[model samples]
Target: MDFWQWYVRRGRIDRRTWWLQYALPIGVLSVLALMADVALGNSSLESIATGETGYGPIVTLVGLLALPASVSSGATRLHDRGMSAWWLLIGLVPLFGQITLLVLTGFLRGDGGPNRYGPPPSAAPTAGPYLQPEPAPEPDRPPYWG
Candidate 1:
């Protein structure tokens, strides 16, 4: 899938894909922020913790860009589990809510088939009707079996 569809689209996303989408950008951005901190002559975590502002703007900008995409992907992941997008608000409820959302989105399997959100993420797109083949004819059988 395209990056936009994978990260920004409001549709279903299975757990495996959700985990990757959720973790990758956060991990990459954290590493980049650490590198920027080091290049600026600050002790990475200590600088951030001490309220140093050197790398803050860079980190803030990257975080602003990533936040919406992260929320969108998370909402879609919730949809895959047959839950409403509103479930994302649970993260605002403090530590317990955040932990609950993590467990629900990261560990639970999605609904078994097509759901209100859409088909399973792994399903192939359907071709036009003209591309479909006719059903095979039935074979002749003995009268007793019939």
Candidate 2:
């Protein structure tokens, strides 16, 4: 599916893709937002570290924007392990549960073949009905010989 469709719960995603594609990007954005806030003097390092008055505006916006996608990514990763998205509720139990989920989705391998969540992730997102890459135009001539 296309990139946006990749955020849905219908697919499976292996650990590498989960980290590199989804998690890292969001994390990078959050860090950048924090940097901007600090540079702009909207928040200080101490405040950000303690979250005394909560996250700065930019970081808050970034988190809000990324929340749905993050949840879906975690759910799809759980699907890769042949578990329901409901398993993510384990994060509610506190630190241990969160760590368990992190290991399950961020370190363990997915099923070798198809399970309930369909085939293993194909590495890159494929085209979907709404968005797709256009075919490249054919060269008028093959090439010139050296």
Candidate 3:
């Protein structure tokens, strides 16, 4: 699937694919969080801590990288439900939005087994119609590398 299409499509990703999709951004964020904690310590009060320089720029950069992936993840989740990605805005309604997003994230609808997004859940094991078929195996020769 293309990146955006993969991002959409109903249902929680199987563990393997989920790790591939989220691991990098999450790992980077974790590293950044670790660095922030090391630099700033875990002080609850902001006023008493020694201010660290140069972290602002780094934190901003990491946030920019992470935010798009996060948005993509959320949008894809909505797409999985056959809903438009814009529905992610439901997360903007204060506590209501939080509850809505929680319900949406916890939902497990599986694209009704496949609609415009791609093949049905049962068909996922086979190539979806959009895929190009592999060349037939040759009896007299090794398979084509191209």
Best by lDDT: 2
Could you tell me the C-alpha RMSD of candidate 1 in Å? 6.8
lDDT of 3 by residue, 3-52 (tens): 76543445434323434666455666857764675576443224324554
TM-score of each: 0.72, 0.76, 0.52
Q: Assess candidate 2 and give its lDDT.
A: 0.83
Highest-TM-score candidate: 2
TM-score computed on alpha carbons, candidate 2: 0.76
Q: Please, what are the lDDT tens digits per residue for candidate 2 over residues 29-55? A: 999998988888888989757868667
The segments of candidate 1 whose C-alpha lies over 4 angstroms from its true place after superposition are 41-44, 50-55, 125-146
TM-score of predicted structure 3: 0.52
Better of 1 and 3 by lDDT: 1
Q: Global lDDT of each model?
A: 0.78, 0.83, 0.59
RMSD of each: 6.8, 7.0, 7.4
List pairs with backbone clashes in candidate 3: 7-76, 9-80, 10-80, 113-120
Q: Candidate 2: where are CA atoms >4 Å away?
A: 1-3, 122-146
